[model samples]
Target: MLHRSGSGGPAVVFLPGAGLVGLDYLNMHNRVAELTTTVLYDRAGTGWSEAAVLPRTAAEVTDELLELLRAADVPGPYLLVGHSLGAAYARHLAQRFPGEVAGLLLLDPFHEDLHARVPQEVRDRLKELESQERPSPTEEQLRFGRSQMAPLFASWPETVRDQLIEHHLRVAWRAGLRESENVYDEVAEELRRAPALPDLPLIVITALGRDATQDQLWSERVLREIHCTTRALHADLASSVPRGEQRILDDAGHGFLHEDRPDAVLQAIADLLHRVEQ
Candidate 1:
C-alpha cells in the first residue's frame, strides 16, 4: 500500500471508507501530514495500493491495517482516524489491540445496529447501490445514477456534492458494493457489546439535524457503540477512558473528514492525540 506520512507529533493512521482512490482524503492527508506524523494508506485493492482478496471480517481488516503500519514503519500507539464503515474497523482494532492504539477519531461513523433498524425509505435509497450495474462514469448508463440517488445526505454544499458524484461516478463501484454488502453488522455489535472498552482517548464527531427514521437509528447505534445515553458519544467515552470527548458538528454529514468543515475534523483528531499524550 502507498503510505502518506510526514507530520511530527504522534503517528496517526487513516482508514478509508470502502472506496478505491482516496481522492476524499487526499487534501486532508496532506494537511494532517504537516500537523502530525500522519499516515493515510490506500487499502488493499484501492488507489495505488496493491490488490488483495479483501478480508471479510473486522478482525481480518484490523490485521491488514497492522501489516500496512508495519510496512510503512508507522510506530504505535496510533491515533486511528476512520470514517463511515472504516469506523467499525477502527473500534474493533482499538478494542482488539489495546496496546497498539492510543486514541480514536471517528468521523460520523456507521454503527451496525443502525443497519438493522434502517427505515424503509433510507433502505430504499441504499437499494439502488445494490440492484443496478456497477457502472463507471465513463459508461453513459450510470450518468445520472449519482444525482438521482441524493437522499443519502441530509444536506451538502456544492463542493461536497461534487465529490460524492466523483465517488459514485469516477471511483470503482464494485468495491462499494462489496463493502456495503459484505461489510457485516456483527463488527458493530462486537464494539457495542464489549464488556469494557480499553483505556484510550476517543473523539466522536456526530452530524445532527437528522430525524427519527435515519437519525434515530444512527444516533441510537452510535450511542450504543459508546454505551452512552448522552447527546454526544464523547461523553460516554469518559465512562470508559480517562480522557475522552465527543463533538457534534451540526452541519457536516457522515463524511465529515473530507467535507467543508475539515478544519474542525482535523482539530478533533489533534485534540484526541493531545489528550492522550498529556
Candidate 2:
C-alpha cells in the first residue's frame, strides 16, 4: 500500500492518477529517491490497498492520505507530485493544510474549472456515455492495451514491469473511471468551495500528445480543440499563484507523461524543490 525510499525532510510523495498504482510511478520514484525522501502509496480502494467504495470525496481521500503519513511517520511539509485525479486531491490537501505542504508538481491535472472550459457537446457526449452500462474489456481489448503499455514500462525493472502490465490490463484500467465518476459534479463543487492554496512553488506540466483513448473517443478536430483548451486551462492554473509556472510537453500524452518524458517531470520537481528551499 505504501513504499518509501531515501531519507530527508519535505519528502516527495507521489499520488497516482486514477486507475494507476503506486508502482506505476516506480521509475520516477526511484529517481526522486536519489534526491530526497519519496513515497508511493495507493488510496483506500485502488492499487494494492484494501477495497473500498469508489468515488470518494476529495476531503475523504486527502484525510486518508494524512492519516497514512502519520502512521508511517514520514513527517510533513511534503513536496507532492500528483497526476490527473491525484492532482485534484493534492490541491485539496494544500488548501486545507497549507503549512503541511512545501510545493506541488501537477501533471496534466484535472481542475474544477475544466467542466466549464470544455465544449457543451463534448460534455453531453461524456454524460451519455456515463449513463450507459460499462462493458468489461474483452480479450482483444486487453491484449491491445497490454501492447500499448509495454513500451512505457520497458525501462522499468523486469519483475515490476511485468506485474504492472498485468495489473493494469486486468483491473487497474477501470480504476480511474470508477474513482473519478463524480469528478464533474460533486468533486468539482467541493474544490470550488474549498479555501485557496497558500503561496508556494507550483509547476503544472501539460502534455499535448494524443493517446489511443483520445483517438477512440473524439474526432481529430475535437482532439485539437481539447489540446488547445487543456493548454489554456493549465496556463490559467499556473498563473493563479505568483510562483506557479507552466511547462508544455509536445511529445507526451496525459496518462504517460512521466514515462514519456521523465526528464521534464524530474526537472520540474527539482526546480520546485529549490524554490521551496529558498
Candidate 3:
C-alpha cells in the first residue's frame, strides 16, 4: 500500500507517526509532489498495509521501508519527512544506510535519549500513566473525536475523509498505541546501539503548544517539563550533524503540527531539499 506522486529524483518520502497512515499527510504530500517525486505508504500492520505484529523493531521497520522503496523503483537518496515514531525509524534508516539518504525533516520526533534527558519524576509519572488500564472509547467519545477531526480533513475528498475518520476512530488509534508499546524499552535500546547518523541536511521541528488531549493526560507541570526537555533534546539532535538545525513552532501541538502549520512543514521540506540539492 503505497502511493507515489510527481516525478523527480531524490524523491521525498513521508513517514507517518504511530496511528497515522501515509494518507494522513496528503496535504503535505500534495504540496511536495508539485516540487519533486513524493511517496506516501503504510508500514506493515498500519494503515492500508498488510497486517503484522505490533511493535516491530526499528531494524524491521527500516528494512521493510527500504524493500518497499526498491520494489516500487523509487530512486534515492531520499529526503525523509518523519513525524513522531516515524522519525525514529527515519533516523535508523539514515544511520544504517547513509548514502541512500539525502536529508531528514523530523517533526516532534521521538528520541531514544528521551528517557535519560528528563527528570526522574517525569519518567515515574509517565510510567504510572502507562500502567493504568485503558478502556475503549465510548460512543460519545467517538462522536466527539470525529467532529474535532473532520474539520482538519475538510479539504480532502468527502469519501476519503469519511473513510479516514471512521478508520481512525475504529482502528488506527489503537494500532498506534500498540506500535508504541516498545518505544521505551526495545526501540530505545536498538537506537542506542546503532551507529551514529552520517552528516547530512537535517532539520528538527519542535512544537511547543499543548493540545486538549495532552492537557487531559498530563498535568501542567509535567507538560511544561516535557516541552522544555523536548526542546533541549531536539536542539541537541539538530546540532549532532554538520548541517543539522532546529525550528520551533510555539502555536502548534505535537500531533497536529502538519495540520496546524502546513506552511512551516513545507518550508522545512523545501529548505532541506535545497540543502540536499546544493
Candidate 4:
C-alpha cells in the first residue's frame, strides 16, 4: 500500500483495473497527492501484496477496502477513482456506502449493459480481447511487453518506471482470469439491481477512439463505430446523475487513457474536487 496524507481535504483512493494493482497509477496519484491525501493499494495477490483466497467476490473486495481504510485510519469521506473493471467496484462502494464516498471519477469505465448496446462487430472485438486462450506470459512476451511499455513510462523517473515494469511483470494472469470469470458478471448484475447513485459529484471520462488516427492495428472505421457506440453509453451514464459530467477523449483506447493524456484525467479529477469542496 502506498498512501500519503496531504494537508487537508477528503482522501482520494484509487481502484485499479483487472490485472493491474495500484502502483500502475503512481504518476496520477503523485499529482493528486500534491493537493489531497491519496491512497493507492494493491488488491490481494497483485503487486507487492500477498495472495488472497480464491473466488474473490465484489462484496468481499469492497469489504477488504473498507477494512484496510479503517485499520490504516484513513478517514472518509473519500473520492473514489476507478478504471475499467475497477469502476464497478467504485460504483458498488458509492451505492452500498454512500455516506463514505463524496464523489466518483470513472476513467474509461465499463458499463454492465455494454454488450447489449454495442454492435455485433464491436461485441466480437470485445470477445477477442476477452479470450481465455492466453494465460501466463511467455518470456519473450514479457520482454516485448516491457519494451512496448517503456515509452509510456517516459513521464516518470527511471526508478519508478523500473519498479512499475517489475510489478507489471508480476501480474497474476490466471488469478485475474479466475476472478473475472467468477466475479465480474455477478458484480455487474448486482450494480444493475442496486439503486441509482445519489446526486453527488461525478465525472465520467470516455475514451472515444473514433478518429482512427492512433497507432493501433484496428481499422479506423471499425474503431470509430465501436467508440461511437461506447460514447453514447457514457453519455447515458452521465445523465443518470444530477451532477455528473462526461468528457470524451477522441482517438484514445481503453485501460490507460490517463497515461496517454494525464492532463485530461487530472482536469476531470480537479473538476470533481471543485464540486467536492463546494
What digit string (tens of lDDT, one per residue) describes model 2 on residues 1-278?
A: 99999888689999999888899899899999888999999999898899989989999999999999989999998999999999999988998999889999999999887778777878998988878876788999989988888887888899788888988887886777789899988888888898887899999999998676778888988888888998998898889889999999999988888988999999998898889889
Ten contiguous residues with the weakest lDDT in model 1 = 225-234
Clashing residue pairs, backbone N/CA/C < 3 A, model 3: none
Estimate, for each residue in 1-278, the C-alpha lDDT of model 1 and write its tens digit.
Answer: 55566856568788877653454566677778877888766676655566666446677778888987887777788888888778778888888888888888876666655555544544565665568775445555455666554654325446555565555556545665575576545566667765455777887776553332345444565534332322333345434565666677655544344555778987887788678778
In the range 60-168, model 4's lDDT, one tens digit per residue, is 7788888898998888988999987788788888888899899999987878877676567766765676674765677998899888778877777776678877566
Query: Residue 34: error of model 4 in Å?
Result: 1.3
Give the range of the ten consecutive residues with the poorest summed lDDT in model 4: 209-218
Runs in model 3 lying further than 4 Å from the true structure: none
- Model 3, range 159-186, lDDT digits (tens) per residue? 6899999889989988998899899889
**What TM-score do all the candidates reach, one by one?**
0.74, 0.96, 0.96, 0.88
- Candidate 3 at residue 192, lDDT? 82
**Candidate 3: worst-modelled 10 consecutive residues by lDDT:** 210-219
Q: Please give the CA lDDT of all the candidate structures.
A: 0.65, 0.89, 0.91, 0.77
Between candidates 1 and 2, the lDDT winner: 2
Number of colliding residue pairs in model 2 = 1
Task: Enumerate residue pairs that collide in model 4.
Answer: none
How far off is residue 174 in model 3, in Å? 0.8
Q: For residue 50, give model 2's deviation from the true position in Å.
A: 0.5
Pairs clashing within candidate 1:
7-36, 7-37, 234-246
- Clashes (N, CA, C under 3 Å) per candidate: 3, 1, 0, 0
Give candidate 1's error at residue 244 in angstroms.
2.9
